[model samples]
Target: MAMHTLIKEKGISGINVHDWTVLSHKTSILNSQEIDNATNELGIPIPEMIFGNNFLSIEHKSGFKLEFKALPALAMVDQSSKSSDLIKVSYAREWFEKRSMANQEHITDVVKPYDWTYSTKYNGTNLSTDKSLVFSPTTSESIDIEQLKKPDPILFYDENILFEDELADNGTAVLTTKVRVMPSCFFILLRFFLRVDDVLFRIYDTRIYHRFGTNTVIRECSTRESSYRETRSRIPRSKGGDLSLLLDSNWVSSQLPEKESQVEVLTLSQA
Candidate 1:
């Protein structure tokens, strides 16, 4: 897979800032050739649905940039090992054995050192042409959930999946990125949601918020997890509850039992 040589055609949509542009692109899922190319390059089965051509980026006039793309994100996945993020699902072996015999072509059989869950802790990527522009840890400011809930007029909004898989009907692992632009600011959420039928529920989220007329961006990342039974027992059978709600990433994200968060801030002029 000579991934660097592959060409993809896409059109971008963007919002202009004084010195930079907030841009995003959406494109169709990869084709057979592209899938094989990616799989061979990554040394693992490509995801069931991979939008290799889709991306979101902040491009600056001075060539400073930060971008998110599928391949680089997946590159962060822990290649399964004794010390790695190994498969925690006990029945994973049985599922893989059964899947290998059914002529399933969408995914290839996993060799050793593979994380079947494909849980990636990706927090986006930096493609900054300038080396000095970087996000620095901060304790003074954070993303404002209340401000974002004010019902401001939305100028642009979009959500796209980086990749997803159904774990042979046992559960699901999906990574999705969403962005919303309002009259005053724009917010971005990149989430990885994983559910193992009877084992656990995990959510890793990244929130990036920038209020217009400011040179600073606030990014907060959090991780939440709960045992399957514990998560199920919390359901109250209302709009925000139900056994089926377990499958809803948004719903489950709200119900998770624990959270650990980290915050960082970046100024438009990092130098």
Candidate 2:
């Protein structure tokens, strides 16, 4: 199936949005295990894995705009040292609605209609009652083309990690990558999904900054978009691997087409 169609199908399907914020000191190390544990406890699936250019940093900041095709259950597990009384949770749905209305008005006010970016900033405390954490939007004011320049403290990539893999008769081919996200990135994406039905699509334009201070933008979006015509033809068996999660010899068998008639076995194996 075409990638575009697949995306549309997933978006049109019932997908839920769950926004999250993590709190940590600037110098603290982000424990991947802790994050995994939290998500696991909530029964939310952890991302398959993380991939990026620089994995190590002192002040690591990242965010995600996820479009889940189905509304997964959400649960919050607090691991902070502070007492629960100190933690406050605030829903920004009203704030988001107001900002969106203003943006629409602003668009109509412009003489020459061009895309304008807006951002908000919220402290972690705004997110919780304890005032321990806040999130703010990063926005740019309306400036003429000549005055336009990338904002300082610019983020070259979005915090969301994309996972892509193809299951084949024998094995699967997987690829993981990160993309740059714009300010108001999360909210804008969330609104889009809320307004649309059955089809959710996102474009992440790749931007590269060379050591010489040169910047390049790659417009081809979607890390999952790939040419599989040739690769698909080369797969050996249409029904090869076992589906069993166990490693023992007892395997589940399933039927396949005549030409590809083979017993599908489930086996415990590592990816």
The lDDT values for all models are 0.75, 0.20
Which runs in model 2 stand beyond 4 Å of their true positions? 1-43, 47-230, 234-271
Task: Identify the runs in model 1 with alpha carbons over 4 angstroms from their true place.
Answer: 1-11, 17-19, 83-112, 238-242
Residue-pair clashes, model 1: 0
What number of clashing residue pairs does each candidate have, in the order they appear? Answer: 0, 40
Q: State in Å the error of residue 174, model 2.
A: 4.4
What are the per-residue Cα lDDT tens digits for candidate 2 across 161-237? 22221211212221222322222221111110000011111112221111111111111111111112222233346
